[model samples]
Target: MTAPNLSANLLVELFVEELPPKALKKLGDAFATTLANSLKNAGLAPSTAAVTAYASPRRLAAHVTDVAAVAADKPVVQKLMPVAVGLDATGNATPALLKKLAALGADAAAVASLRRENDGKAEVLFYDSLAKGATLAEGLQKAIEAALAALPIPKVMTYQLADGWSSVNFVRPAHALLALHGNEVVPVSVLGLNSGRQTHGHRFEAAVDPVIIANADSYPETLLRNGSVIASFAERKAEIARQLAAAAAQAGADLKPIEDDALLDEVTALVERPNVLIGQFEEEFLAVPQECLILTMKANQKYFPLLDTAGTLTNKFLVVSNIRPEDASAVIGGNERVVRPRLADAKFFFDQDRKKSLESRLPGLAKVVYHNKLGTQGERVQRVAAIARAIADELGGGELTKQAEQAALLAKADLLTDMVGEFPELQGIMGRYYAQHDGLPAEVADAIEDHYKPRFAGDSLPRSRVGVVVALADKLETLAGMFGIGQIPTGDKDPFALRRHALGVIRMLAENDLALPLDRLLNGVFAQFTGVDGFQANPAALSAFIYERLAGNLREQGYSAQEVDAVVSQQPQRLGDIPKRLAAVRAFSALPEAAALAAANKRVGNILKKIEGTVEARVDPALFVEAAETALHAALVEVVPQADAAFDTGDYTQSLTALAALRAPVDAFFDGVMVNADDPALRANRQGLLAKLHAAMNKVADISRLQ
Candidate 1:
């Protein structure tokens, strides 16, 4: 069959064994993009060509419209040697020029028509020709090879081809390769397989063994009609979601399948033709914690457990089966049977874990090494308890400290439980369950779970004051211990998740509006590691690391970098004050006088930094020689108290606003007075006055940072 011109579309499919469910969509997208890009780059497809990617369990495919059978030829340019070297002394073609021309498929006869242009330093000969474009067959072959090479295959299988002697490596063993331009089969071969217009679909349900693709444009419809498969990954996923919702609604209006994009993507990859089925297990399995039941069902069986309106896991679940039968009871029954054992195991682990009180499991932690240099989990627990108590005492000294200490002691006890051992993601969650079963107070039980609060970005903070205190202490201990042992995170290599830990601490302190000082918390955590060998406290460095995380977090929250820097650069002891400080700086920045004042503050800071000794804010009125200096001192006398009073009461916006009144006098002083006077006493007095001004303006935030 003769290939059609640019009007016809192209279809390419690689039918194979089941691909990695998690990686199938990515592979499909990459394949289509890479292939389309290669074709476009080779001039075989227009830049506006429409590309559609398809992925099913057994196949990956792409259909591109507006593709060409053969690309249009284009001009080509070659930079030959410089003119002086190409031509002889008599301007004849030299041997070097002829040989170079010959290498480029040109001959001596073409030299007379060669064009010369100055290439900056020398005149160079240029050869121009119309280069023949690649045909569809040639471009398709190269594009397929390039696309396969660029796939992000998590793992590859090496298997013998049909020839038995040849082997091919791919994500899965390939069964067929299909390529078509219009109705014509494009002659492209890969992995020992030649291109054809036939591919298999739905191993069990297909009407035909080898589904024949009618044309490039009708592939999806033909596959669905004859092969019983949905070719598009997104379409299949959406269909699954729709079916799941329908099934859930059929059971009850309040019943809904758990929503997880990752699980949906994975299930979409596992099936070629999805049939949503409802399944159920014995209600006795509901005795297990819902998290454990949900985890087992989702992780082991790829089932979507249903949740009630209260978000409590129900005995019912949804299964996305690859087959659709007239009677789905058999399929539903089989899935129910398959998930029962997993639920039973979860129940067993939960029952066995509850038999022993959480406190009884505490001793088992001593056998579990938390870190090589940091000693056992038991020791870490003790340190965390001490830090928690100290922080709680600072927050308030009564029952809060007692609950925090209790919660910290039992936080890691769940690590020894069978349920947590099998599912590490449920460590804190299981700890809360076990703690409550052991008759611990609800506050302590919640804290046991919440000590890992704000675990990931956007995660919620602890729900109670006890949870907050313990969470802060836990994160602080981790940051201090890691930084103390010089296990600081560098570049992308934060294996210990120290950056997350730091951000957690920042979030709790700032978001919770805790009264705890960051430096003191760092010191307390470091103090806990005193007797450990090879441990050196670097609270300063750790403090800086935490502040950097806080700055980044604030900036991510839509605060300007200057606003964040102004507040973060002060190294505010109490992180709770940072929001107020940032708000104050932002407000100050909008005032017309703010720029001049900030500049004056920056200048004053630079002058003060140049001196060897500290410039105390102890100024002498008698030494104010310049009228401008006298005016500035008087302005400070009026503004400083108002600013300090507003600052002391947490009215940061008012405090910064008060400083705006000094902008004119400060500018006048800088413009009219020389701080570096001939007399050292006058210079010292002037520096002292400037220091007072700096102290007043920076009470809320370092205004100089705004500059």
Candidate 2:
């Protein structure tokens, strides 16, 4: 029998064919975490045990420190039936009790050892037993099975084992499985493969056919020394980044690889051994838009495009090779040759696309259906143009109106261009280039591209006034159209990216501090869809949706939820003022009187709500039977003008601060006056006094939310 206290580092590896590059990192992390957590849960490892995860193109491995060979025994107490059911009138065991004991590997002879205890309602018979611990072999087998079952495989592959009779499903066909506790094989199986101490390394650069891991602690070094592979995914990615930077510096001063974490992860997942090499295409291909060339190289060939100090794409790029050769000239030359044709293709698309102006492509949009209920792209463009014109007029019409309308019309035209057809991501980008070629106004050309600004969170808003107007119109049309057709996002199912569109609109308005009212904007955009069938304009629903998105966004920016709710709950029409209002609320919350005032404000609101009808702010001075009421009324007269002046000038912080003086009188009034008095006239007068206080206090925000 294995010693109960025996402990050692454990190693597990699943060797297989290449995994999906995008999903490799997630799979490795999940496998290691799930396996370690299972052992910890089963009491085979301590909660503080250290675990390390490693992934290469062909293997996923884990090393866990200080795992036990056999779990410790634990005591368990199980409740049998009530004492009345377990015993007879003669104080003898019943047959039902005997049956339950038998299932627990006990018999009637053990009845004397049973204990009686109250289980909340009645005295019940309890049985105590020691559960035998699980051996490492048993625990590891379950852990391996659990780990494989929990992998986030993008897609599963089914294949037959070598024996041809058995089959299994995994991310890829399993070639071998390696499991070890210290230096001993743990005897586990997964994906039709038995655990062993051997794993293959790099395809061609490895010094051995099957590298042998002597112990769990030596797995990484052993694989690296004999197999010519870097075992850790993070370490390999870091090495690639270092090499890319060095190569870029050597190529030229101020040159660096484009920054894309996703691309780096994918490249790391595609190789076991990384060797960064410099490759170049003809400088003539640089005439094509750098975006097109850079995207093709990165997306298709997994190459990193180098950029100059000015952020201009250079003729050179970096290639991460899977093998390290003494002479990398052939590899570099082969990459250059392969990329030449791709650049040529980009050039071809650019040349062919420039033959027609963006205005000429406008007719092509009619053939493309945007959404079944929302009409074609051509119609959508018209709606966006109309919204842009109305918004520009609101902001002061002139050249701005014409530029915004022109930009909106030409924005979606490039979606029909050859370059954009090949690369859908180049939709707005290509529009700007083609507009420039067609000799349109620089403002209009820039707006065509900038209208798609803030496509994702943390992205910049439109750069100019025309751009902001057009972007607002574009995003608003999408939101109004989708919400009007009842395609609102529920849960995570935002197929149309309506959430992103809403966020884009919010960011533009708030970040740019545009003077547009949200209600008016939504109504105008919804009005654009009046004649379309199956379109019902619900500006209220759209406004609520935008405000909800704004609330979440504000909270994420580090404001307390109470502060955000206080400002957002009012559904302030001017979204640009949200930041100032939130600042004011936060500042007001720090005051000594803030808490008392908030509670008093809440009390006042509750009292007013209980009344049958609206309580006017007008109060009769003659009805002030209590000094507290008179003092409160006198304080409001002193504070209202100062607060209103600050508020009119957009000094929200000062506006909220001015109300702090009224907290004392307000508290005293609530303490001394009975709002619902026996005299109807007096009670109504008191409520009106409270109403005036509530209105003045809540102008900046609903301070009651701070309560």
Candidate 3:
């Protein structure tokens, strides 16, 4: 072990081909451990050494600060047992040894122990250690080289070394090896680059190499001074952002950087000394829709979209190119030329979409298949329309009924249009545009557009009640039809995105305060599929499927996973009702008197749970024995109407509040009364009271489920 006061640090930088960000951190950790462990395993430990690994798109480096001038001498080594295991086991070694000797035709003289025998037992494993006063330069080189060669090398290159340059692979060719100890270059070689006192900077902007580096401490500053590309990921990112903002100002607009960090990081890689360029397109392309233009720039060409002060799309755009252009006019011209064809295609699609009314396209959807189990998009639209009509009646029809019908009929029509088929995301939006173009009512157009909303979790819900009803109707049919045909979602495989559709339905109802029963609507949606398409409906199975999904949807909305499970278990009713009930139950559970109330409910549930026969749960007040049982029965009688009214009014807090009334009576009854009495009538009377208690708590949800 070295003295505790050693101070010379060993800094090894592998300026090899560029590396992926993920690999850089891993290589650094591995290098540091290898440096420390290689020394530690040899019974040698250095004082105050830290291996810090940071990466850019280009290089992987490990810097050990406060390392000893020399490595600890003790070395970690692997001693091998040359003999085979089959020969070494048992006392029959003589015969087994002879066989192995003859098989390899190798003499026994040089055959080392194939395993180490600590305490006279065989161990094929080797013990590695570090020795004190070892060579720092040797250990650093070996560690860096071994770690590099061990992992699947990336972005590799070869160089001429007094011979022909051979083909090697890396993110980039290893440029130079720079290992330093206190401003002195440590002579080492890796990936064909010998350790040097200098390094290169920016490739095109400042292609300086062999620029002397004082030490690892001076790396960042030296690169900037010598016109070299400094290996700094954060620095590169900030520079890109700065250049992008400046270019936006130059173009007389505020540029909106796509807020995806991963995308930004990827764009950073293809540049060095980024030169931001501002360009503009013809205002006529604006007729092609903002989506088309933005996508054409951001997704297709990696250009940034720019907007005016009022957040309106300006004709201007910003782009980051790798190097500066002497004549920016040529660059601007080239970008404009490349964008013209995309704009032309967009304009052509826009013209084609308006050629025929969206209503005229409704019949064209018949050719498209929904799925092998489900009917075509045309048939699905019909199902949506039917369900929409039913939901409208339930919601108290007005303009909503007509709006719902309009949206449902034209919803899938866009799937038949060339423009929407090319851009599935623009389905509802395009449908609304086309409907308006066809002189449809504004309200109807709004519903049509809003129907496809909340497509993903946390996405906005349908804006109008008509839109909400139509969307629910659409999703319900998919869920029901798919379930009827046995195309139910499985682990990680909701290929139909049934989970999303189901969640969307729940969100729509909850957000809009719609009180429609989930089970009834589900039944209505699937009833059209009875014996049609050769798929039979199992009502229980389909209802249960929806319940599970509803529970999953609620759980996704921050309800406890266990709480969701508890509610579904107790109230397994309509899929839509449970979310409201669960909120009530969860809120009730968190209250001061909740556990006591739940305990009373549990007493009621536990008795009812055991009574399976038709007569077991039937109430008969005539058989009531104890005062506590009678008191609890009377308490539940009062709570039932209040609970029902609360549920009826969608006042979840009120429903849960009324149920808490039975807590005292329930607890008193359980404390004083015996549920299983010696007389059958007395016991039956107690069970009946318990059933009533269960009913009181269950106005909103299954009381048994809450706990």
**Candidate closest to the true structure, highest lDDT:** 2
Which 10 residues in a row give candidate 3 its minimum summed lDDT?
39-48
After TM-score superposition, the amount by which residue 321's alpha carbon in candidate 3 deviates from its true location, in angstroms, is 1.9
Q: Estimate the TM-score of every prediction.
A: 0.96, 0.98, 0.75
Name the runs in model 1 displaced over 4 angstroms. Answer: 1-7
The lDDT of model 3 is: 0.68
The number of the candidate with the highest TM-score is 2
lDDT of 1: 0.91
Residue-level lDDT tens digits of model 2 in 461-482: 8889999999999999998998
TM-score of 1: 0.96
lDDT of each: 0.91, 0.92, 0.68
Give stretches of model 3 more than 4 Å off.
1-201, 210-219, 222-230, 253-263, 397-399, 416-425, 481-487, 530-568, 571-587, 590-592, 615-617, 703-707
lDDT of 3 by residue, 1-707 (tens): 23333545555666654556445545545655665555443323344456565345555555666655564454545443433443455523455555554554444542443334553555442334443565556666666666666554454555444335555444456777778766666677766668876665666666466567777677666766785454555566688888877777676645454454655665565454667787788999887767767766766777777876665677777777766768888887788788778778878887898999888888877888888677788888888898898899888887778778878998778777777776677778877877888898876777788887778877888777777888888888877887778888888898888888877876776667676766676678778776566776766776676667777776767988767876777644444566667777778887777877766666666666677774344677776777887787788778888888877877877888877777788778878988889888787777766666666676666555555
Alpha-carbon deviation at 133 in model 3, angstroms: 13
lDDT of 1 at 546: 85
